[model samples]
Target: MYRIELDRDVCISSGKCVAESPETFRFDSDEIVELVPGAPRLPDEEIFDLARDCPSGAIRVFEGDEEIDVH
Candidate 1:
């Protein structure tokens, strides 16, 4: 299984992730990207694409302890 995480400190509030996968991500009170609780999950490839599309490179996908390089 793959795990996705948002680096809030690195996030630029681009909303690209939310726009691409609103079911998996959302904006917090401060407009930083956050994972939605109990939201529907996206496939690993879709998640990777989302990360690749992130301008700030804030989205990170990991398999176990290894971080996948989206670029």
Candidate 2:
């Protein structure tokens, strides 16, 4: 299982995360990024790609409490 965290302050609104995993992410009314509540689980590879594709490096992927793919 995995958990996703997004840093709205660091987000650039690039839409890369949403484009890669539409069911997992969406834009809020403020135009910032937010993880979809109760978003469907995604494969590990897809999780890595979501973080990798984030130009602002605002997306935080976690396995339990350990963050992944946030470089």
Candidate 3:
């Protein structure tokens, strides 16, 4: 399975990730982006898209330790 991570220190909270995939991403009380704990499994393409859409480059996807990217 894949893992999702959000670095709030770098996130700008543009809401693009939430708008693209609310099922797996959301905004915290502080307006920073966060992963939805226990979220349903998402396709690799969608996950990559979410990471690509994050303006601040805060979202990271991994299969173990290897980071994922759109290209």
Candidate 4:
């Protein structure tokens, strides 16, 4: 299983994440990325790809206690 997190302060508002995974992520009024409520879980590889694709490195993926290094 995997977990995901986003750092709003670190987001660049590039919209890459939202564009790639509209079902899982969206932009708020301020344009910062926010997770969609009750969104379906993505596959493990997709989760890692999404995190790695964040230009601002704002997306974080984890497996239990250890954070996956997507950089």
Candidate 5:
């Protein structure tokens, strides 16, 4: 299983993360991105893509002991 974390303070609401993986990330009525608990269960490659594509670098994904930094 993969775990996701979002830095609400650093998020700029660019929506790139949502666009890249809608199932994984979404925007609330206020336009803040919300990460679903277990959605967007992407493969390792997609997780990396999401990290690389996030413009604000606010998203972080973790697998076991490994942590992926996503912006």
Candidate 6:
């Protein structure tokens, strides 16, 4: 399983991540990216792409016993 973490403070409210992975990310009423909880599983590449594409560098992707800093 992969874990995604978002730094709201650092997020610039950009939708780049959402564009990259709509299934895993969405914009709230305030247009801030929100990650759904307990959704279907995602491959590591999708998570990596979402994190890499985030303009605000607020996304962090992690795997079991491993961590990748997309920022």
| Candidate No. with top lDDT | 4
Clashing pairs in 1: none
Q: Candidate 2, residues 1-71: lDDT per residue as tens digits?
A: 77678889999998888887889889999888888888888887777778878899888888888887556
Which ranges in model 4 have alpha carbons more than 4 Å from their true place? none
RMSD of 3: 1.4
Per TM-score, the best of the predicted structures is 4
Off by over 4 Å in 5: 37-40, 69-71
Model 6, span 1-71: residue lDDT tens: 78888888888987787776677788888877888766666787777877888777888787776777665
lDDT, candidate 2, at 11: 99
Model 5: how far residue 35 lies from native, Å: 1.5
Q: Give me the overall lDDT of model 2.
A: 0.83
Better of 3 and 5 by TM-score: 3
Candidate 2 regions off by >4 Å?
A: 69-71
- Stretches of candidate 6 exceeding 4 Å from the true structure: 64-66
**Where does model 3 exceed 4 Å of error?**
none
- lDDT by candidate, in order shown: 0.91, 0.83, 0.84, 0.93, 0.77, 0.78
lDDT of 3 at 46: 81
Cα displacement (angstroms), candidate 4, residue 14, comes to 0.4
What is the TM-score of candidate 2?
A: 0.85
lDDT of 3 at 57: 88
Worst 10 residues of 3 by lDDT: 62-71
CA shift of 40, model 5, Å:
4.3
Judge candidate 3 at residue 58 and give its lDDT: 91
31 Cα displacement, candidate 2 (Å): 0.7
TM-score of each: 0.94, 0.85, 0.86, 0.95, 0.74, 0.77
lDDT of 1 by residue, 4-58 (tens): 9889999999888888888889999999999999987788889889989999999
lDDT per residue as tens, model 3, 6-25: 88899998999898888878
